[model samples]
Target: MVTAAIGLEFVKQFLNLNNPPEFVFACCRDPATATDLKEIVKSNSSVIIVELDVTKQESVEKAKSHVASIVGTKGLNLLINNSGLINSQRIGDVTREDMLKCYEVNAIGPLMVAQAFLPLLRQAAGQQSSEPMSCSKAAIINISSGVASITENSSGGMYPSRASKAALNMITSNLSLDLKTDGILCTAINPGWVKTEMGGPNALITTEESVEGIMSVLEKLKGEEDSGRFYHGVKGQTIPW
Candidate 1:
């Protein structure tokens, strides 16, 4: 539901462009169960919905296959690693299992997705035959959080989410260096206090506004030189490590 809402808003604005970009919305659950998302797929024939479980390697591979079969060797121009989960637990109350689960989903998942989809991204960078390829740039956007920066609150609890996001930031920095030669820009983006299922009711921003600001930032991303840095939403600011 969260994925559908965010994707719908982003795609609605994205399709409004003078030249709309091709898009795909991937999820772990069956598409048949997501009627609202299915409506999006129906309304936008250009948008493809695929089943993807970022936490599972097999699921990621299956998603890659589905994408390859649909888009072919040309590759994807942009990859948004927006899949994440948050658990509210205090430090003394934290459990080992939950900590591992948080790391798997928040940190390792994006890394797996990046590794799995890199060939296609590299292909997108190399292909000169198409419009997306004509741009000659591929980017990976890792959605992160503010808690990753200040761990004061984390010391008492919520260690998993905070620590994992920090690790994700590190992964983005490292990937920016590793993929620079391939012309794949990898960066972490803090979406701010958006009111989603995870962000709760009192959050400062709505998902629509947050995504709008994020898309704006993404549309302006140029090349590998912009990789590895941390960007805050539509305010056009950078977050310190």
Candidate 2:
């Protein structure tokens, strides 16, 4: 899991699971600065805070190495690309810097992280003899947004955020196909208009509500049957690309 507003909720929910993960790497750009994240997981020995900057390849590789060292032959089972950046600028106000930065963080970052962690994901998948593709074996979940849906777009604005997230949706689809042979499932999930710094206080749902819905959808994901799909986290409904 990654550490952010919604990412923190995921960590909490995962911890509360009846059968919690053996270890949850609460990754963030700077562990030293993530006071809230640190405080919540301090008492739990299983939650390990990792320093990871998704936008930087060096940082991604470093985090991968650290995780690989710890997980050893067991390898990693699940990777949630929960890191994101939002640029709310409209077409007239959006700049090249805004567009590029959002694209780098929201679209390219997940791809880079997945590339760096492919060996571990493959290692975990290879360990599963003839078992079906599942998160327990290996899976990549990209946290996307509903605004990325081109088909569902009614009001047009937020050029950077919309475009970058749309690109992310495409990346998720490609990853699903590319990693299918390795039995790795990849999917993009829209956590809905949650009440977070990004989502704003006027958002439709709470972080708990959004994560609960996301967890429900994730729990039901199956092999190729569910791969490469865009989902509404709150409703568990498919969204058009």
Candidate 3:
């Protein structure tokens, strides 16, 4: 799976894996300021750092160019949309600016990234021509949330995060339909309440646990019909939409 440096958990998992030869491109906005991310780079030679700002078209196009150069004939097997924005604001207390900004990053950013990298995904599918005619194709894993679930909103607060994630789900569903013809698989995953900056210290899962579960999901999931499905990060269980 191609995981971005939204959190180093996925990166850490990829680095430690003793599996088949799958390239991991750690795309982010600024590698220079990413001290923790840079430190991870010191240990691994396969990880390629490409500058990407998913919120901006120009930055994504530039990043696509850089990744394309690196991935010449091979193309990309997976594109992981892990970058997210969370604005903790109550419904009445939320500012207009924060609401829009949340949607821009959480919802729209993934769309832009997927659009920019589609050709590369197609290339990867073509490269695997000898494989069986299965739905196990090029994939895009979107790090979505349980908060976005309209069926499970018991507390009903986090307006910005909830709304933006819901929008992201819509994008994922449409993307699956739109890209399936090209043998591209697209799906959304809720990483659960992990102890990250956004998930906070009291959360149930650790980054390691979350990443482990996510990796399993990417490895085992199958079929084009499975694309656009919302998966709970724990053991790739199907979540109710």
As a TM-score, model 2 comes out at 0.97
Q: Kindly report which residue pairs in candidate 2 clash with one another.
A: none
Residue-level lDDT tens digits of model 3 in 78-197: 888887887778978998888899899899988898888888988988876655223235777889999988888889888999999999998999998987777788889999888877
What value of lDDT does candidate 1 attain over all alpha carbons? 0.76
The parts of candidate 3 lying over 4 Å away from their true place are 1-6, 20-22, 129-136
Tell me the tens digit of each residue's lDDT in model 2 across 30-95: 888999888977788889889998888999999999999999999899999987888889878989
Per-prediction TM-score, please?
0.90, 0.97, 0.92
Best candidate, lDDT-wise? 2
**Lowest summed-lDDT stretch of 10 residues in model 3?**
128-137
Candidate with better lDDT, 1 vs 3: 3
Over 4 Å off, model 2? none
